[model samples]
Target: MQKLSELDHQRRIRLVDLHEPQFERDYPHIDRNAALAALHGELPDGQVLKGLDTSHRAWSLVGRGWLTAPLRWPLLRLVADGCYRLFARHRYRISLWLTGRARCDGNRCGPKT
Candidate 1:
């Protein structure tokens, strides 16, 4: 938690647990441009950053496969498949963290009500 606090303090990352009521209240007001700006600010000067994220659903598998279709000749599919299986089995929540698909139906993800 301390490390997370430090990271948040530095604006290196914004941690939002979907189950938090505050997120429900603040989601509508979060400015995507400002979030992008914060992300850029967290990086070192003169560095460039680009983000690519997708849902953890079946359709996204096709999207990812299509996006990397050009690299099939180099056996990249094996690597991508391995990563997908690993995350799906052990770190599925992390895989869907940004998408909020991992939120518990109950209050299990955050403080109990």
Candidate 2:
């Protein structure tokens, strides 16, 4: 997310961390559980877009439009969506393995009491 923000030279993208207390208050229209479970984007018009749709739009804003342009093809889009789902499903474990910790703060990723 930091990398993407840096690439967004125009400052058009606003990356909100789902763990923030103000998230629910700020985006009451979005489902907290659903947003926590996957990637989500709240457009300026208040539309809550999710998953690969949000990703492509964000990438385009960061000047990496070519990265998701392949999704314009129906077949490629289907395949990419499937892959994204797979990754999202296991993201926590993957992050732990890669970073030696979850991507989120310890309180959020730690075992519930």
Candidate 3:
């Protein structure tokens, strides 16, 4: 019964889990145009700017993920995925808090309710 019950939470958790690391790995590369789009709610359209994301940590940490889900298609999706990488920021990384650096959940995420 324990296994069966966890199975349900598994789906929802997995949905977030499955996409987390993919974002973490690709976050550093979030381009400038993408950053501007995130900031202004509009794409570069025709601008040619580079080096937009020198500090990927800021948006990924303070910013929210679901807010960027609308862009989950084509090139824009990559930017959305960058949001996930925010969790990987060194300050929030699991190892920084945990003793052995093992698995992390709601408890490990931050202060408890």
Candidate 4:
């Protein structure tokens, strides 16, 4: 499994913090279900918040409404085999969305507060 990078983990944490309240109110009954789903298996972003993996290449998992803010539904590894075919390659530049690496000049994707 690809290790979760600092930026990625932090991004998830931020998203979780923002959504915890909604979870409490709207899906109060499904907290257990959500946790269960995340733990039991990997799903698409549009399917659930957990398990879905992102890549510099293409979606390791993809769904119809996956790119939206509130992912509409959960999707599984339907995009894996040749999933890389879906997107243009993204040679991740720490400078593009992260910084402080040897390949970067500290120009962009600077340190977070």
Candidate 5:
């Protein structure tokens, strides 16, 4: 497990403080099955909030050696694989967009489609 930089650590704390309350307000009735899917686990809402608070902090701290650590290597690989899958799914559309952007007069993506 890699350690977080001081700046990243502060950022994570601020983000958690900002978002934790929103999560509580947004999912007051988080026991509902519909809420379970959004919670990302079977844990109660408060626990879910805590997990998210930590997970998102970890996410923000990625790419600073943490991503390449033994514990996070597989997760990073999975993220890369997911990116490839997304590119495959939207390859043609992305290509078309790029092509249009290349031919744009300035930087307007080819006259707004």
Candidate 6:
């Protein structure tokens, strides 16, 4: 997330900590429990979007837009979604293997639970 925030030179993305006290007050429409379980997005118009597809679309705004452009193709999008799910499911384990840490502390990766 820090890397992605740095890449967002326009400062368009707001990184909100789910555990923060003000999270519910600020994003009243979002269900904290569900958000902790998966990626979620609240658009400017208050539309709540979820899953890796929404995440990739949001990433398109940054310099990495080209990477997600292939998602326009239906087949590639389907494959990408599957890969995203797999990654999300085992991300903590993958982080442990790659970085020698669970990467869950400080809510850096995702919910501790």
> For this target, which candidate reaches the highest lDDT against the unseen true structure?
2
Candidate 3 runs further than 4 Å off:
1-69, 88-107
**In model 6, what is the error at residue 31, expressed in angstroms?**
1.8
User: Which residue pairs of candidate 6 clash?
Assistant: none
- TM-score top scorer: 2
- Lowest lDDT sum, 10 consecutive residues, model 5, at 36-45
* Model 5 C-alpha lDDT versus the unseen true structure: 0.42
Cα lDDT of model 5 by residue, 40-103, tens digit: 3223334544223344435555534343343335666567545545664554468679775442
List candidate 6 segments past 4 Å from native: 105-113
Candidate 6's clash total is 0
lDDT of 4 at 86: 30
- Structural similarity to truth (TM-score) of each candidate: 0.28, 0.84, 0.23, 0.21, 0.25, 0.79
Q: What is the lDDT of residue 7 in candidate 5?
A: 48
Report, for every candidate in turn, its global Cα lDDT versus the true structure. Answer: 0.39, 0.80, 0.36, 0.33, 0.42, 0.76
Candidate 2 per-residue lDDT, tens place, 16-63, comes to 877678988988888877876678997888887788888888999888
lDDT of 1 by residue, 1-113 (tens): 23334434334443454444575476554444433322211123433322222121211233333543533435764676556455544443673576656634453542223
How big is the positional error of residue 12 in model 6, measured in Å on the Cα after superposition? 0.8
On lDDT, the stronger of 4 and 5 is: 5
What is candidate 6's TM-score against the reference?
Answer: 0.79
Which regions of candidate 1 fall more than 4 Å away from where they truly are? Answer: 1-9, 28-82, 85-107, 110-113
How much is the lDDT of residue 34 in candidate 1?
39
Pitting candidate 1 against candidate 2, the one with the higher lDDT is 2
Worst-scoring 10-residue span by lDDT in model 6: 104-113
Candidate 4: residue 55 lDDT (0-100): 32
Candidates sorted by lDDT, best first: 2, 6, 5, 1, 3, 4
